[model samples]
Target: MRISGPTDRRGVTAPAAGRWSAGRARPRVLFLATSYPVYEGAAEGVFVARLAESLIPFVRVLVLAPCPPAAAKRSPRARGRKRVRVVCLRYAPARLRLLAQGPGGIPASLARRPWLWVLVPALLWAMFVGARRALRGACLLHAHWAVCGAVGGLAARLRGRPVVTTLRGEDVNRAARSFVHRLVLRACVALSSRVVVVSEALAQRVRRLVQAADPIVIPNGVGPEFFELDPPSRGDHFEVLFIGSLIPRKRPDLLVEALRTVPGARLTLLGDGPERPHLESMARAEGLSRRVRFMGQVAPERVLEYLSSAEAVVVSSEREGRPNALLEAMAAGRAVVVSDFDGAAEVVEDGVSGLMFPRGDADALAARLRSLQEDPAMVRRLGQAARARMRSLGLRWEDTAARYARLYEELLSEHGGAAGEDGMERGGRNGAA
Candidate 1:
């Protein structure tokens, strides 16, 4: 019942201020997400944090996310020059709060430890209560995932505010397979003033759930750091980087298996998940321990380091929704070998911008890696093409934020709560940022 107020970078309690009550020029947006970066440079949901940061110039952003066990005593990191206020909601006992962290996110955590289902009600209730408290002066609610959208939808209904729900990868891919999840997703979509899907594949899935739903397709954008990375010189051995959770869905094990055929390639797995131990054991059993390095969950800067030094980046996932990692690797101008998931074609032009292999096919993946290893010219060609594609597509965080800002204005005007004239001008200026 006790919701903490927003705190500054120094962890000092700030005064309770609302958008209109405080006489702010911009409308306030409350971002509801189950996963968010707890500290600066943290890899967890960095996209959400980045989007929130990019939106700051146009609107006031307040992110509400679950407090991880490690960050229980401290406040979430304030990132970028323009700070976004992040309020961490404590849902359960510190030790028992394992729902939102690690790989696979909420559904994966629940699947791994079914007993943790006991905390679901507590988490939902906590989010609802915290959202209501945070909605005091907020004009609209922006929920990151369907679960948060469901909670935000209810809160917005009560407060008579609009809710904008963004359906990320797992929320649509995994949630559609279950009856209860499908029902919840339907309700979330029904209650949303606007629905945004990160990929065309996800948008298709949303339509299947609700035929009338017209979800906007907006892929997640890469930070400027990725684009500014210097091109890596070709090494003696081809360095292949896999930069995502080691969860089953991500299929990092496929990359490890692919390495067996690619003797000249060294693989660096730069993420952590429940499958890490199993993958490590698999690597050792296959006598590939030395060749496969498991670098579990580094900071964002470290991720950029790995991306910059790699000859090629591989995404061996079985499913995805326009992965930010893929976009970032391409932006960094690294030759990418991505599995041909549903929406793979939308981002990469297969043989042109990047290489794609059949999903879950280790031999095909190995072939792609071997080709990249042997053909440095092709690698450079593809890398440059990928970078050019990103540039032409305008896949920057500021651009994405500008699109969302316009949508927010349209929704606000429809609901008779549009921002003031200054706010509209600032929203239009997002492109110049």
Candidate 2:
């Protein structure tokens, strides 16, 4: 695929023109993700949508995602994101959506409350139906999480489309916990044309599950705006930031514990989830109520403002898939103290870019915090190094989209073209152009 200059009707400017075979048309990508941005202020799955949007200029992309059934009442949040056409399929009833598809994402929803398993069947069935309807003119399928990958795999098998499944952290990490989970994970791997993971650690885990499956590691990226390099706005007291859902896996409580060891340090928690109340209470119990600020759920565009203002960012997660929170912080030139979770080593270099402590070790984390506190110059140096590393790596959404576009072309070449009803290959026509 050659990069050609052209802007599509969707308002996304194509950096390069993409090609399949010599005579084929531009490929069309249908993305399947259980979590996607439904409205403008939605904090969930904005990364998934960003990938789809980036691909729009390179290919025709249509996103088939499930929104809470009640979201129909709100105005569309996709005003500026005109690159991809999003179809929000409803899986649960309005009142039952919170129980079935909680804000913590599908896997976390089920893990936290096992009783919600009752609604899974309906969710999968709905996705299957939606995928079938959306696959009519699409040439390839890209599923974000394993659960959605399972649904996409089934639909692809029926429709004869090549499906690529991207495994984000919990989808594979917790797959072995139950029979259904394992079965779904296997189905996703078995049906995929290629498997993609955000981190090398996750790729190793997938190989252990399916020896034949070799997953490609493509780490998530940060936007250039986040890397604008504003002067450090160190306030009277050190301000640290934590941006993620307050779930058990994220270990926000551990960050709270570490904060107890550092005096005169303030924290800003910038996301909400099921565990917010418990975390809030824990903060209060430790007399950290004044130092901790819970700025629950801000819009995606505003994250850079918080990152630029903070002296450091903390990622104390039990697990991760190359967290965007850490990536954004690094790009914004902020010092970091991240738990050495599964994918942590790939992103942060200890003492080079930032510090990495063993997962769940509050004392180790506190010690690192103390080091940064004692020397403000060290914090500035580390933040600058982190940004420099990110710059050298070229971690941006544009680069990510180009990689995906090439992968789609490779899969398209193997498949020849869209399949006819009789399982015959037809001339490769991307979309209804």
Candidate 3:
């Protein structure tokens, strides 16, 4: 299929003209993911949505994601421009569908409620069916997490199409702990035509699991909205922002504890999860209820507003694969205090672009906050430097989309198909498998 330069009515600029000839049909790519936004302006899996949108100029995208029971009624099969369509697969009954709706995703949900494992068969079956149907017009499959990788890999294999699996942080982290997860991850790595990791640290983790696997490192990108935001002003109090799920892995509790020592500093948590109650209780116990505000699950579009209001943003995750929040905060010109996780150093230079504290060390994080609180000038310097670093690195969604497009073209060619054409040989039934 040929790439078109037709601009939609929304005034979005199309890709450069004459990039691809108009004789062939555009290659269709199926994106398989466990987490995706149920509606427009949603914060859940918004990075996935952003990436899908960015690819509109390069390839046709079909996103297949699981629909949480609560969201099934409102979730639309199509979103945004016509070039990208999102199909949400319904796996379990309304009351019983609790697997992919929680803080840490399926693993966290399973950990919280052990009985939910019974739904695994239904979920996998639904994904298999949905992917099988979606792959009919698809040139290749791009699976986001390990779970999607497993399901999409199988579907692609059966359909005789190529697969590209992207390993984000949680999947690799899970593989590092469980043998079963490792086996699944190994299968995903082996079955895929190409493997993509969000960070070098994650690539290393994958290498440890399967020595023969060589994964490409493609970091997620920040949207232009973040970079367009005006520099934040110093508020009356030192406002520290934390923008992530209130999950244990994110260490929101540590942020709360760190706020205890920074006397006048106020902490604003912009997301919610199963750990909310625990973090709220911790704040109350530490007598920090007045200073800490839990703003539950802000929209992706509004994140820049909060970032623009804060002097500094803190990422206290114990592990990460290049957090979007960290990148967005930097792009919004906010001083960042990130934990020294494996991949964090690649994103921030300690005391240069941003500050780094020991992971899970409440005291060290508190000290970092205190230093920022005392020196407003330092915050400005760091924030400006962070923004400069992001610009220098070209961490825009367009840049990331271009890289994926190149990878897609490379894979299609290697698979004995030509891009910008009806590449894949059709051999499947029109209906779901």
Candidate 4:
């Protein structure tokens, strides 16, 4: 139950003592994502790509993720998997457009349509039949979410490799209300010798949900080099942007309603989900569609471009485990207007770096929005404060990798070379499609 170090006092540094042999003899580490850098996606791929960059110099890496099943049965775009060879799994159906735009990927969406359970089992079986061997050579297995960790933990146990699981947003934040999901996640957390969560709130939540589930709280990081302060350019409209999935929890409708009080100002949304069509309908109903533009979904590379060109990025999520989108937005020097979720409040200070409103209160949200929009000087001051706040936090990609690497080493020490946690790696027996 111990992790490597806090690293704040030590500063970000590589492991100089544990040097590996030269040439092709690097310590091999296997990174697992139920879905990897699917060429297109959200936080999962973003975190994976960043982790890959951090771990490459330290270990020989192989990123294992889901690829399309058979081309004929998959979408033409899903065939994009032909590009990478180091990946180890592919169970995505022919119907998926891509990983991000995939119709049934998100947890809330998956919870609504139970039939997709078929895909989970099919994926587990495929990973078993396909991945058991490669894992034997792997130093450790690191999964992005509990489900992905369930798959990886089970596989790693079968192959006798150390396994680590990360408690991502929906997986840990919303676990309390979902009985079946909590059971499965508990099993994964129990089996995982080490579990990592982004926020202290989420870490405590996981501890309450699972037995012996002592999770390490490592707040997500933004590459300092990438998201520096790029002060707003002149002639830019007082634009406020909301970038997240169009789901109920995100509360984008609140953004639409907030527009009622902020006259002549423009609001932009940059994602798609179950609520998109309804949200669009609501926007037109309010006549604010004239001021709001739904960008549907945009590429990750283009995300910073959008943030760079805006005034502030607003967050309206009902719940969060430290959103990757907001950090990126803040790192880009844009002020934030987040919903009054505890997680959001944890990061933003009122009238300081950013502002927050009571959950679902459109009026309060609009007032905050209007305040930032009308006063350019206030916006500039807040943006500068936000940038300075983040810069002082001691977060970077190298810190994140070192934290996970240390936790893995600690988990190995506690669990020993014998058998590991039980239920998580037992997925094969858990019924199939």
Candidate 5:
């Protein structure tokens, strides 16, 4: 990693061909994301990093994201190993960075530390400045969330560039709950050249927020890395896996409650969040401190290992755009039980590739878990079917990245044509080309 500009303090060197050029106008894209993997192999928003990596071969991608204050001590190698360049802007003080708005998403972070609200202006200003600096001679901008989209859209508008925004789960479900957030998000959607959502359910929500909003449905793709590893054989004890932030929406507490009904069943949670202590206390109260294991946060590769070892994977999120956990588990040949909310039904077919239960229903969830435990053959069959379904869907990261590349090309063509028309308008009297 080498420094390039004043604002470009951190960067990851890409492939020989993907490096920045000062003489030629290569098709470049600026990505605005608030949540990204901070540490090496950190589990936070690894999908964002994966998508950025996948897009590197197609275009010169530069990511402008917020770095958690506490991550000032991050190892040099923790940035990433890909063609995409990332510059993390620190908005909070060093000691307070851990409480800043980055990790468990803006909603959860704000909930954890309300005083951080004072830093919102600084955070947005930092992103604005970073986006302005990164957008020099860039053809397109793609923001990962509504907030980022709003900020990045302003920067792109200033540069007269086309901007696209992807409304992943929380941007619509959590942030959109607030009146001010809805207003800002609607403005962002209005400014976006294209609005992309991971699921049709989210597209519908976007339409409600902005009546004229017509969002394209682009599901998140599973990477080939997850498919390369084979799952370990199931054991005698019924073991299930839950891999996501332990937030209220994730409903890990309900998963623990369901385990109480299933007697000897074990649940291993593989991510950390603000809700961990409360969830642990709930599990202890139910006398399940022994069966429920909180693995905290693990490396991205270890997630696949845990998925490979488990008999089934459960996604108990009350609201989601598209959970990588569900998709990765499906791709890894493991039976999945997802909550019947948000986009769960879009990816899962009940009694087919996986099972879907009503959210917050511990009894229903326990019944489904017990059924799989009683019939190991059904578990294996479901898992096999899930793997096949994922393959048939053709949800590969390479393909997903190519689709965005096509979109970027279209935007660049539009921009070029617009510029040409404006030039002719300015010098039509002189017959200028």
Candidate 6:
């Protein structure tokens, strides 16, 4: 990592390329996302949590998201801090129910009550005021998704702080397809001095759609501490783990069908969503009630234990931008059988690191699972291979944090005192960037 200017510290390296450590003065960044502590959508929430924690080593990061509910304001503590302080909407009555449900849970709730649209502007106003205050010492605005970034970029531009936006899956793949969303997303990416994406495919998409100042591809890195190699033979009954929301996109239903195909195979689905009832009924109807189990919403730390015990972790999502659970499974030396999506292909090279299957094909997924189940040798080989490859990849939290810090510094330097609130200043607000 190269420091843009003469860094104040002697030992710490700037968070630039080729650097392994952080500079002495950690930047204070305000992270805006759709929601935090999101229990339903495991992958996004998990990765976001890791990103925030990883950034903490090089920067003081505060995670700011709209509270899906009114209860977040009155629920428990006056303030809460865990590595990063999670701030929610102070008083949103109609939306409070959504807050109680979760970030993913709120969308449908908002849709059903069309009357709620009238309150969005006021809710955003309150959020801006609260965010501005919480950002008292923040140097830059770092938003996770495009819509939030579009709004936050405007807010940061209002406050004279640089904005760095990261485009994730749904925000780009689905939402960006909409004209309004596409316009806002492009504007957000263009206005901010820095634009970031998780994959090369995404980078190309952005380039084709908009003229970005300097777009960078920064894939989400996994923390090495989260995984450990589990011996292949520990299983009494081959425990197969599927770690994702029970949402339709994740396609947990395919996993159920896979379990049925692989007789005696015990499958654990760890999440909750609108599709739970349908998935549960399928299990009952298929007489798979005994073989398949739905363990809704487990803690992040607890996930590793489940993966550690399972013979292999399966990813059956119709689409993805590099599944974090897939990475974690690989990190744990557990073989992954993922849908053949571009993002999953980035991590899993078929038959080498992990197995790849066609998207939404339960039969294809089952056949792959049977091959691995029948051949323990292949499982061990692939699992060990995946672990070795990931270790070499250096998917550590510090590595992730350092990259963001360097990018932040680089952007601030590049902008060179652009007066736009969303433009990167020579020195970030309070000299944090």
Q: Write the per-residue lDDT of candidate 5 for residues 1-433, one digit (tens) a residue.
A: 1112122112222222333344323355678888777556566677877787776554556667777654567652233244456677777676666533344777788888798788788888988888877777456789988888898899889878789898887778754578887877887887789989988899988888778899998778897877765754657668899998877888888898899888768889998888899989988899999989999888887887787679989988888888888888999889999889876777889999999999999899999999998888889889888889888877777666666766665766677632222211121121110
lDDT of each: 0.82, 0.79, 0.82, 0.66, 0.75, 0.68
Distance from true location, Cα of 259 in model 2, Å: 1.2
User: In model 1, how large is the Cα lDDT of residue 239?
Assistant: 95
**Model 6: what TM-score?**
0.83
What are the clashing pairs of model 2? 3-16, 3-17, 4-16, 4-17, 40-77
Where is the poorest 10-residue window by lDDT in model 3?
A: 424-433
TM-score of each: 0.90, 0.90, 0.91, 0.83, 0.88, 0.83
Compared with the true structure, what per-residue lDDT tens digits does model 2 show for residues 1-433?
3322454444333356443344434556788888887767777888887787776556677788777654667665553233467787776676666543245687678777788789878878888999877777677789998877888888987888899899988888777466767777888898888899998999998888767788998777788888896847667878888999988889988878889999988889999888889988989999999999999988898898787779889999998888888988999889999998887878789998999999999889889988988889989999999999888777788777777777776777777744433322223543322
Regions of candidate 4 where Cα sits further than 4 Å from its true position:
1-10, 14-25, 40-44, 68-88, 96-104, 108-114, 128-131, 233-236, 409-433
**lDDT score of residue 115 within candidate 1:** 93
The best candidate in terms of TM-score? 3
Clashing pairs in 3: 1-25, 1-26, 1-420, 1-421, 2-24, 2-25, 2-26
Q: CA lDDT of 274 in candidate 6?
A: 71
Determine which window of 10 residues in candidate 4 has minimal summed lDDT: 424-433
Q: Is candidate 1 or candidate 4 better by lDDT?
A: 1
Residue lDDT tens for model 3, 1-433: 2233454344333453333343444678899988887665456788888888877667767788877765755645344344357777788767787888456788778878999999899999999899987787788899999878888899888888889898889889888899998888988887888999989988998898899899998888888878778877776788999999988899999988888889999999999888999999999999999999999988787887788789989999998888999999999889999999999988899999999999889999999999998998999999999999998887888777777877886787787664323433222211111
Instruction: Show model 1 residue runs off by greater than 4 Å.
Output: 1-24, 73-75, 418-433
Residues 298-388 of candidate 1 have per-residue lDDT tens digits of: 8876788788789999998888888988999999999999999988898899889999999999999999999988899999999999999
